[model samples]
Target: MIGKLNHVAIAVPDLEAACITYRDALGASLSQRQELPEHGVTVVFIDLGNTKVELLEPLGENSPIAQFLERNPTGGMHHICYEVPDIRSARDRLLAEGARVLGDGEPKIGAHGKPVLFLHPKDFCGTLVELEEV
Candidate 1:
């Protein structure tokens, strides 16, 4: 099933400003900005010792992050990702247990360049859960 806490994603209005806040103000090292057109987000990763924090900015109007921003103008936690030994197996288990998977219920390439699937928020205490194959 799920393994270690992979990363926590935050939807932000401004990617640069968020990076600056984490870099200059919080003394965190930021990774290079990566634009994921397929997922519709431009992201920056703040590397913490054990886990990473992902800052996401909408790449287009249809981006999910954009909708999230519309709800919380100042931005907020978008989702939390957990590592999985095998994404397909984990997905099947979740499906059998009656958990809804987002999108087509298939894994897509995620920010980490790994196969990832997002579970429905309502199925997980209103918190979006992402499972990444490690």
Candidate 2:
């Protein structure tokens, strides 16, 4: 089962501009940009009091974010992550309930260094959902 809202991920065409918007205009504290080659993204976390905002920029041409950007050049909310106590169990339950998991249906290390899995957008009312173990 899902727990607290972990973070909302946004895909951006310009990582620096997005970081500046959150850091300077919004007065938010942000982490240094981290390249997650495994996930094919370069990310920066914007610290919000209760939750965080994840900014994602495609790391390579094959990156999923690149495809997303191709669909929406302006970029937008890519996914919403929710915390889970047990990722495997949560995945199993989702599978049994006929929900589709993205990728190989396995958990991968996320930006927070936590196990994370992405659910198919179509399965969650057209919004991609990410479950991160905490």
- Cα lDDT tens digits, model 1, 34-86, are 99888899999888999999999999659978878999999999999999999
Any runs in candidate 2 off by more than 4 Å, and if so which?
Answer: none
Q: Which segments of candidate 1 are over 4 A away from where they belong?
A: none
Q: What TM-score against the true fold does each predicted structure earn?
A: 0.95, 0.93
TM-score of 1: 0.95
Residue-level lDDT for 55 in candidate 1:
95
Q: Local distance difference test, per candidate?
A: 0.92, 0.92
Q: Which 10-residue window in model 1 sums to the lowest lDDT? A: 60-69
